[model samples]
Target chain A: MNQDILVKAIDVTKNYGHFRALDKVGLEVARGEVSCIIGPSGSGKSTLLRCINLLERMDGGAIWVNDELIGYRRDGNNLHEISDAEISRQRRRIGMVFQRFNLFPHKTALENIIEGPVQVLGEAVNEARERAMALLERVGLADKANHYPSELSGGQQQRVAIARAMGMRPDLILFDEPTSALDPELVSEVLDVMRNLAASGMTMIVVTHELGFARNVANTVTFMEAGKVVETGLASEVLSAPRSARTAEFIKAVHS
Target chain B: MTTASLTSSMSSTAETKYEIAHLRLVPKRHVGRMVAAAAVLVLLAALVRAFSVGQIEWSYVRDFLFAPAILDGLANTLLMTVAAMCLGIVLGVIVAIMRISGNPVLSSIAIGYVWIFRGAPALLQLMLWFNLALIFPTLGIPGLFEMRTVDVMTPFVAAVLGLGISQGAYTSEVVRSGLLSVDSGQYEAARTIGMTQMLMLRRIVLPQAMRVMVPPIGNEVIGMVKLTSLASVIQYSEILHNAQIIYFANTRVLELLLVASFWYLAVVSVLSIGQHYIERYFGRGSKSIRSSI
Candidate 1:
């Protein structure tokens, strides 16, 4: 548990019935670093990322964000499970962008961005609107502020999702296949937003198959296989010339 | 060169003629079948006309349908319908919430409500409420007060209670389906942004669910509008019952029944058109509607 680590998962394990989704997984994400988790579908990469934000509760393990254990608290001899409300409160510190964008369709882009700030942070509507406008501008969707998610293109919607997560001023943001749903031509726009966010020193845990983006923007790359972290190191080491045989196979499979 | 151009044009024209000769247009047999079907329908209509046993008194039809008493009955019918609808919608929202509530007891209660009312016939429910005096001579509120049995169970009271309660059950299921039609991810997204459950329901869930629920509930409204006629069986004197009384006195049963049918048709037609516009309003922005599914 290094003090520099913004998130640390110690031997985290998650089971869905007989199948283990995450198996004794341990990882650390340092502050102000972009870490990308790459694996095939059902390789537990997305599940691991979800665990960081307590979106998917672990069956066994301890998760700490800024050294605060999530999903549980001990009082005397009793370990009281955290309520959903409490979990929601903790989730505010770590925003998540879903694969489907999950933008509130009933809300306009500007409103979606401001919703967290106004509702969770208790900011005034005017102040929330101001910050939302600035974030929308940053995401290059200032013109689409009043547009609903249905009206926006998939890439634009993902950008709005990014802006919505950023609205909370979270310490770290988790992206679960953010650009996977976008058209091939539109993928780069969302990846560009992520790259910009990474450049701005935002701590991020991105689960993606976009090897090129991982090589360019990610500071660290962790390759997962069958619910285990098979390789972890600098992005170049993992992406360019991986030491592990599984990593090499995965990279080759991705390339071909 | 002009002679060569004329020969080339003649060759192209000959090719067009060959293609047209090979084309098969509509078959003559299909037209013959259509005419045979039309002739059968005409024969059936003629047979029905020949078997006419009695004449309908047009004057009796006019009197029963347009009389002031029957019109008043129609007004009462409308009033009962509107009141039941308002109550049903309000109850529906509550029950839908209960069904989705985290508390098991509340959810089960909602489930039981939908089960019992929807399981039973609406007519049976009306009869049961009309004869509720047999069940409870006096319904009392402890620490509050009580009223006489007859006073507490009037026909008007019975009709509203019966119809509204029954409608609520069906409406709840409709509303729940609407709410469930929305993605659970929407709720999660709203909560992640820190909106309270109340705010989320009001701003996010209900508006979206309403778009899904409007058509079904509009169908329910039309159904309930006709269902009000059943209340007349308990001597509530709705449009149909008033027509029955008038025609029985005049011995013009067919005319009176026709009069009632005409009114029902009129109301239903208006409501059907209303339902269309409402469906259209919510259909905007929906992908399925835009694609004409």
Candidate 2:
């Protein structure tokens, strides 16, 4: 409801057959703030994040990004709305990093980073390459720029994925368990990069099980259980000492 | 100190005993495998001898296989195989895109094409097109207000069309399976970066899918090489047809048939080898990593 919010979801619901993946979920993300969502496996955290990008369409309610209404295209009375192409174009402004570090396997890290800029933004190839090099350096993977995904370690690949997302110059970045698939020792490297991004004032929404990073980096931490947000507040308040029984139980489970 | 040394000696002996036991078991397993393999080899040799005993005519086979006309037919066979495969791959890519397109009508049209061609016997399809003159006297052109009849459906034209179209259907499904083999996440990744669907397909999805799809497609190419022999039925005068004409006139059925078979085998062997190298080239980077571990 805040005018300063970059993203607002009002009573958003997503249904699959008779099951409700997200039930009347409402949330808002303000400009230049990192919001971390923490939940159990089936708690619909991912569904909520995906709905923000219209990757998964919401069954009810409204979503606005930069005050532009999402999921509907007004026509002359008929309202022939929500084409895939339109959603894809909107998705450009909201970059998403998957749990699996979904870098294009066939392309080198440099090509992966430059692909979106050159192809979608119509930036010249050389310009895109230069920007991609800077991004790769920022992600601490300047040396590994020419390496393919298969040739890199999981941690390295995830960094390349971050660089790829950053290359698009999106308004917000969505991270779906970015470090969950990484090895224990490699987790810190990705978290360190994320911390740097956070410090630099990049708006990010991360769905992660790394409570340590979540506590250290996120401005707001939301706790959800079974398709509903149980508690959301300042990271230290929610993560260190949750209010609701469900949030407390989740914290206990994660910590233990 | 004496007691400690005695205990250590006992433990060392125990470890040696366990090692001996393991080593003794290994050779027994090895001997059993060797004996089983020997039996298989004996059985295979007996079967080969039985099948090949008096059927082969060494001299006639040697002479006919290397004949000038047969060699020419072999060249023609290879030419058609390469040309058809090149054309089929291009057509296959187009059809695969159509099949996966967002438009329902275009998708259905692609599905219908694959279904009709794949369901019908390829030989029958070839014959039908070759004999299409009987079914439709004229093919009407609407805008130009002209009609071109059965006279246009010459055997060569029909053969190429028939083979190419049928090959396209099978190749499309091959390509589609390849495309589908790529992770949907890759497409999403590319799109998020703002890559157009076409560019994404070209640079990301297709390259990866082609790696997965290559072996089956290579099989299709080899199969197409042999399938071109079907053109002989429509009097298209490919290798097999040319052989048939020579054999009928000379009345040397087995010898001439052998010549055709030899040529087919030779060309297919070369193509199969080429396919192996191609697959290896793509596989090398992945394979080295796997093998090193």
Candidate 3:
């Protein structure tokens, strides 16, 4: 119940028919803290991040952002599903950046950044455009604002995607493998931007394979395996000295 | 010589042995293509001679080109086409959305609508609408007002309803395919950005879907232009109907038919050009990448 906690998940469970994608997963992200969830592919790292934003509904338990339960409302003894409008209202403060850099292909970089502010929040066009331009500049893409997603390099597109997430003025941003789709050379550029964001005191939950980023930028690191968190501690403590054999093995494999 | 110089000299000798840059390049003759072209030209010339010498009177065709009745019919045809297409597109979007809805009842209703409308012949649908009075003698609010079905179901109404409803069925499939063509990631991105389902569809999904939809929708529009002539069966007074009436009186069937054909071709040609521009408009971001490939 700490007021500083931006995200709190308790016993979060998700299933894909017979296969449990996430099982009794619990995590906490304090305000202005970066938490990295690292695990092997299909180990529910991305699923945990998705469940936080209600992109994938949890089958059991709940998640809270900014002290308010997401996707549902408590009514006496029952938790009733909230209306889509209410869910959208709640989601307004929780931004998400995707691995594929799902920018509106029809829109330019500046337009993609301004879309949520202009359409969802109903901000003035000029105001939104001004802020969007600032975001473009912040991501080192000020000159590429007019370029479409196809016109951009993978690194540039991911930076624009990050700026798009920031443009909504989210209290927290969930990045679902944001750099997994990037080329090896492009990964560092996106990671650099994320590092700047972390330095700026933005709360973020990043599901990634980049242990180097986790070590440098993240305050807390959670190692997940088979839908369960294996270790959660300070980035240095967890990465340098993992308690779980699975975590160590996975880390060694990644390093190799 | 140093190793680099020795290697360069050896490579240059090897290159010169294979080099034939001074050879004259001769283009291959496409004998088959030339023969095909000559045959087509001869055929075209023969057809032109036959048309010129045929019993068709060019004077009547010229005189009737701008005739008031024909112009009125043209206007009516255009009006029907536009109105029916507007109705079709709106209904199609709704039906397509419903078809893909999670609710079983809505999906079933959409499936039934597509099945009934798309399966039946458009001609039969027009006849049924024209003669709807047989099934229901009156059509109006039950207690407030009453009007004869025959009066309400005029040729225009019947034709519009029949054509538009049938067009909607085909259009729904086109729209559904278009909607499906967009990546699932786009939907997730839109939702995360706090857009409502409708807003997401209107802005993110549909605009991207438009690139896939325009070509087929353009084909539908051109098809609709010609399909309006089918309404003539219900006395809708489209171009073909007016031409039929003239040919019936003057017995100048071929000339009048030719006039109608010319107009249809002209309208369709213009529409084709419009479709090209529209495709270009929707194909903004992806066009460059596609053309490069």
Candidate 4:
């Protein structure tokens, strides 16, 4: 019921054929809040994040971003799905970082950051270029501005991805395992950029296996298991001394 | 302790030797390599002899190669190649998209178009288009005042339609496979940023797909330059047709045919450079760093 909530899910359910991806999954993220979703694979954390961004249409229930219903428009008692263009317009305000830094292979690092704003927003190309340069600088990649994704290390690429998501100036940025694909030594650099973004009061919902990042940067930590939210609470409490037995089991397993 | 101190003092005063690691050279020979070398030498010597002393009538070739009619025919061949390719590529992009658009009806129609055009012999298809006047007699809006098919369809028009449609069938498959080669993550990444399907195709999917599409499309373009000869059957005034007219009167069939072949080689040779540049343009961001072995 909080008016300041940036994203709210109301019993959302998703299915891939007969397999349930999200089963009555519900969570709320407030404005400027860093909400971390932690779970083992196939636990619906990524699905929930995707459903919020309207990348994947939920088969049942509803998701709201800033009080606007995503993917569908309600008419009387029924919900009619909107056109792709409309969904795209809504998606412009929700940036996402994939596990595999999906920067355009044909474009340079700076070009990748500028593409979304210039193409989707119809912003002036020169203006977008300037902003993209600033982003590149912010991510400690000003020197690598003209380099392609392939030319950079994994850590550098992920930093560029974070900067790219930030360029949209989105209301919410969903990171679906942002650092999971990086080399062990490369993970911290990406996490550092994400940490800076969190400190700057950017709204981020990260789905990661990095328990340390969840404990440190996230304001709220959510544990998901088998297409359901096992527990959700303040980071210090839920992570350190989770009330749910499944959450405790997962924490112990991760520690071991 | 006394032995250890004595060894330390001796080692500090000892001269170091710069020793070369032992290296051995074994005389290894490949029977396949020897056989290949012999074949290549034989082929090269044969080619040189043919060029220098072969009865190709080099003087006659020179005289007719730049003949005005031959030049005009060359022009027509080039025109047909460029025009048909333009039309084919436009249709190819559309049909390729339709094939993957997730619409059953559109996909089926695209598949049917490809199947019929690609499955049948191209020469047969060209003849059918040429003789279409005989089959229909008149072609237009059924009851809205039909025009005679002969008047409506000239040899050039028929040639372009037949060649373009046939080329399009192959181009569609090449393009479809190219698009499929791009990772699904690229599409999802573009869609996540609020990019529409068309925008994504132009900016994201197609650029990446262009890398895969170029080599095959390059082959198609080179093949098309030669395929335009098929239009000769429709009385299309292309190189081979013009060459035939010259040879039929003069009774120098091989000489005129050589002239046409000469022109084709020239055009395709030039196209190879353009293809290389286009491939390089699309291949920019794909280079990964590697250390020397």
Candidate 5:
């Protein structure tokens, strides 16, 4: 119910058959705060981020975005699953950037950026196109606007992906290891864009392995392990001086 | 530019270290390729000579090519092909979607439909449709209106239904494979962008699927052009049937047959050209093709 809270997940759980992917995961991200979830593979950091935007349905508990419960309607003691249209509408408030970039290969970078606005939000094509160009410029890809995803370098494609996520004017963006698929040299370009996005006061929930980006850019850092939040605190404290042995060990492993 | 740079770098390295002159490269010649080319040319010439000198009246073939009966038959063949293909493609897309749907009943129904139509021979399906009056006797609503099955099931109607329905079965599989060829990430991207399922399919998925689907669908269309001849069994009056009728009367069987063959070849060649352009259109933005201006 806090007005400052942009995204809140309480006791969220997800299961792929018998294997629990997320177990009682709870986190809250305030408006304009960049929160990064860091852990090893299969720790459910990505799953938790996915559940916050209703990309993966939670088997237990609920998620709220600005006091609005997502993916279901609660009436008295019963929960009615929302329709696909309703889910789609709710998803519009949250944009996601994938590790693979996942740009529409059939379209130009500019077209990819404008698709969400023109197609889903019914914004005018001309206006959407104008805004798309601006986003491309912001990501330093104005020259590659007409280039398809296949024509761009890995870093450029990821930057375009960021521009695409920004095109919809979402209140918050979820990034799932946005630079993991990039080459080592290409990683900084994408991280630089994310760093700028953070500096611009855009609320972001990033599941990433980029420890340096987390240490510098993220306001709050949450360490997850095996579907549970192992540690959550200020970025400096968690990365430099952790309370739990698990967080300290993870930080050590990542550093080494 | 890269090749030029590489050659310059190699020359510089050779000059600095090995003191070796740039090697003079000679292209290798394969005697077997030369022999094969000569053999193919000779075989082609002999075949062309045999066809020209064969026992056939060239004048009859020429005269009958554009005869009234043959022209009408050609019209009927083209019409039937277009009608059946339209029906088949529409039904094929629907069936393919159903086959991939989450509902068990719809998926199973699509499976059964494909199994039945694809399992039977095209000729057998045509016979069954042409003779359907024997089973139904009458069709249409029981109380509101009714008509004799024999009257409703004309050869044209029967042929279209038979060929179109069978074509739908094969096309459904091609379409399904095409849809599956799209990456899962594309679907997730569409979802994150807040696109409805139908909207995503139409705007995002189907266009990408077209690249995979068009080649197979072109093969099917070309196959359908020749398959229209099978309708002659039910007297649908296509090109082959008209050719047979003329030959039966004039006793110029080979000539009429040659005329029919020429038309079939001509139509299929034009269609092959058309298929090439369509493939090019869908191939845009793919790895092999350069971006448009």
Candidate 6:
């Protein structure tokens, strides 16, 4: 484990019944790295993101954030599962954006952004509000501070979700297909926000089918096949001249 | 402010019209609705005539409808309804949460509670509560103050316990459904945001769930108002009980029953109107009231 590695998963295994979702997988993301995981459907790309956040627990192996083991504590050689309170405390350090853009429909855009900071971290209400406003402005939705999620378009909602994750000031943000649910025309706005965030040196792990965004914004690209990382390299080389037959086949299929 | 500008609203207009149209009517057959209305009116007119002009003694009913004793009974009935519903809703929320808490012990206890209270008849439960002394002669703790069970189990206390516990059983089901109505994504969002269970329920889950919970709960509240009449069976001195006592003495059973029925109808109508407004209030942020519980 390099000290510079912000997130590291060593031989992490997960199973749903007889199906192995993650078959002894390993991944490491350095601080300020924008790493993209690209794969076909059911290739465990989303499952990997979920495991990193402890939204779905891995049946075997362990995950670490910074220097701390996530969702568990090391006791001698045995690993003891931590309390939900502890898991949530760790989760506060990481932000996640869902495929469905899971904004709280009951609250306005500003309220949604401020909810995590004020409610979880106990930040001052006014402070959280001001920070939320700034993030909304950064996302180009400052004017929509009072708009409920139901009133927002899918692109606008995903942007707010991004701002909301940014409002946490998290060390890393995990995006699981954030633009999958948007209209083809609307995908550009969400991708633009991600590009800006990556350019500003935010650490991010994005699982996406959008090869263009992956190539344009991601520094590192990892190709996954059947719950295993098959290829890893710089985004340009991986997309243009991949070394694995599996990766080449997938890229050709996607391009065609 | 944020809109899905992927597609704009379309506008259209009719450019040409050739002919003005008139609605056609078939006059060969009588309208079913008209026939039904005529039948209903005649039946209602006959019933009203029978009640107003028959030997039920309308003057006795009119005199005692607003009498001091009858008014006192009405007051007692309203008090019982409010107090019992308050207890029921509070207990119901706890039980509903327990039922869904995922802890086997808590959920089993909640299930057993709903089963017993809902399974037994209300009248029987009331009687048991009133005579609770026979089963538990004294209510107390070791090294603490003690009192006779019968002394504590007054008719008023017994009535509230019986009606409220039963209502709580029904309300728990209604509340559980309401809680379930909220999307699971909301729960996950709260969890990912590092919200505790209590705060998640208070701020995120319940606010959304209330939109679905209000209408059925309003129905329960009105139902409780009528349910208080069962208190009279235990001599709780509510509206029906007062009427019963007066009729028992004066032998004006029909007149007394009519007054109670009128009051019941009046209270239910008022509660229904209140329910409509409350539903609208919680229904905000959504498109329409089409998804009401």
Give the poorly placed runs of model 5, Cα more than 4 Å off. Answer: A1-3, B1-46, B291-293
Which numbered prediction scores highest in DockQ against the true structure?
4
**TM per model?**
0.85, 0.84, 0.95, 0.92, 0.92, 0.92
Candidate 6 per-residue C-alpha lDDT over A132-237 given as tens digits, one digit per residue, 9 for 90 to 100: 9999988899999999888889999999999989988899999999999999999999999999999888999999989998888887899998898899888999
Query: lDDT, candidate 3, residue A59?
Result: 97
> Per-residue lDDT for A162 in model 5?
92
Give the interface RMSD of candidate 3.
Answer: 0.8
Q: How close is candidate 6 to the true structure, as a TM-score?
A: 0.92
lDDT of 4 at B202: 95
Off by over 4 Å in 1: A1-4, A114-130, A240-243, B1-18, B21-33, B36-54, B60-66, B90-111, B196-201, B248-252, B291-293
lDDT, each prediction:
0.86, 0.83, 0.93, 0.91, 0.93, 0.89
Tens-digit per-residue lDDT, A32-59, candidate 4: 8999999899999999998988878899
Tens digit per residue, CA lDDT, model 3, B1-293: 99999999999999988888898999999999999999999999999999999998999999898888888888899999999999899999999999998989999999999999999998899999999999999988999999999999999999999999999999999999999999999999999999999999999999989888899999999999999999999999999999999999999999998888888889999999998888887887784635843
Chain A alone, model 6, TM-score? 0.98
- Tens digits of per-residue lDDT, candidate 5, B1-47, equal 69999999989887878754686878999999999999999999999
Residue ranges of candidate 4 with Cα displaced over 4 Å: A1-3, B1-26, B29-36, B39-55, B142-146, B288-293
**Per-candidate chain B TM:** 0.84, 0.80, 0.90, 0.85, 0.88, 0.87
lDDT of 2 at A213: 86
Which sections of candidate 6 miss by over 4 Å? A1-3, B1-30, B290-293
Relative to the unseen true structure, what is the Cα RMSD of model 5? 6.4
Docking class of 5: medium
lDDT of 4 by residue, B1-293 (tens): 69999998777666343333555766888989999999999999999998778667777789999999999999999999999998899999999999999999999999999999999877888888888988899988888889988887788888888889999999999999999999998998898888998999999999999999999999999999999999999899999999999999988888899999999999999999999888887788877312211
Model 3, stretches more than 4 Å misplaced?
A1-3, B1-27, B289-293
lDDT of 3 at A12: 97
DockQ of each model against the real complex? 0.36, 0.37, 0.72, 0.74, 0.65, 0.50
For each prediction, how big is the interface RMSD? 2.6, 2.6, 0.8, 0.7, 0.8, 1.2
lDDT of 2: 0.83
- Write the residue-wise lDDT of candidate 1 on B97-181 in tens digits: 9999999999999999988887888778878888887867777896698776667777777788788888999899889999999
Residue pairs in candidate 3 whose N, alpha carbon or C atoms collide under 3 angstroms: none
> Between which residue pairs do clashes occur in model 2?
A116-B193
